[model samples]
Target: MPYLVPPHIPSGRIADGAQPALTADGGLCLRPWEYTDAPAVLAAFSDPVIQRWHLRRADSEDEALDWIEQWQEAWLAETGIHWAVVRPKGGTSDGAEQLLGRVSLRSLMLGTGQAECAYWTLPAARGQGVAPRSVTAVARWAFDEIGFERLELAHSVMNAASCRVAAKSGFSLEGTRRRGHLHADGWHDMHIHARVRDDEASCVPVEGAGPGAP
Candidate 1:
């Protein structure tokens, strides 16, 4: 079955003010992934931090292209939203559209208005509020325009930065699941956080407010 945007969602373009080229703090833009980005994606995934957090494997150029192509198809099919975090020209110290990271919402239940959120950022993008900003933008869109009732964010207990992002995005910590994933370190606990439509008032405005203020 084709994925459908919920009927209750107000009709409007999906990437309105949120265009792929749309600029956010630190000259970063959340753009749709493309096959041409395969090399950069692979390089970004090669980062030890990214691999550790996301459990990504080293991939050949062809494999990387295939992965991006699949994400493109999924986006067109409305099955989910996946975006590459790019560094805008003249913004970063290096004038390059480096792949700082990626963010996505999947396992969507439109009828029930719920989905799962996930993201990871390159080390260069860390400590700059990139993850929180990206997550906030997507979550607001999901709730206000996509008509989702709730969005869930889960992370390994050791991932303090991700936990901070969830909290900064107004997600209340729900609970922890014991032994969620078997990692090389050990069976890790998973921390779950959630944001509901009723808590829309908690969404921090995109333009104003300092870190963790919204």
Candidate 2:
């Protein structure tokens, strides 16, 4: 049996090249994770909020390193990619970057031109619009550069903060899935949000949160 349409993204289109660093609103940078970031990853997973929403914890630095390695490998595999959301330590371009959050295109389905965007901001970065900024940047890249037709974002209905981030990032609320996902506490209703490539509004950054803003 033959399909009527071609794959939205051709194979090797992403796996053939190196991942590029992305700049987002509010002086944020999204880059590939490095081994040196293991400590920060450990710290993030250690946070109670992250552990709850993410449903996993890094028990040690070595485990965190493994996770970083997997993120790098995922990019090469072209199944998905993850970025470390960072803020430069000083007011200069040469300054070191501090990790504030993470954004990823997970469960990538290139043939169908779809993927799920997931993110979590550090405790200190919460309420600072880090998640939405990173998400918007990634979505633009996915749509404009990679030719993906749609991106989805889903969160537990109980996660009000995540729901707000989805809206701010231009992912429209599609609907709710009853007990769609199981968290550590058990089942929870999930809100599904999405942004399509043709939606010009999806490319616009939220007010007061555009790139390079203070």
Scored by CA lDDT, what does every candidate get? 0.71, 0.85
lDDT of 1: 0.71
Off by over 4 Å in 1: 1-26, 93-95, 200-214
Tens-digit per-residue lDDT, 101-164, candidate 2: 8899999999999999998888777766788889999999999999999999988888887877
Over 7-33, each residue of candidate 1 has an lDDT whose tens digit, in order, gives: 543323343334343445555688888
What RMSD value applies to candidate 1? 5.4
- The CA lDDT at 39 in model 1 is 85
Give per-residue lDDT, candidate 2, residue 191: 93
**Clash-forming residue pairs, model 1:** none
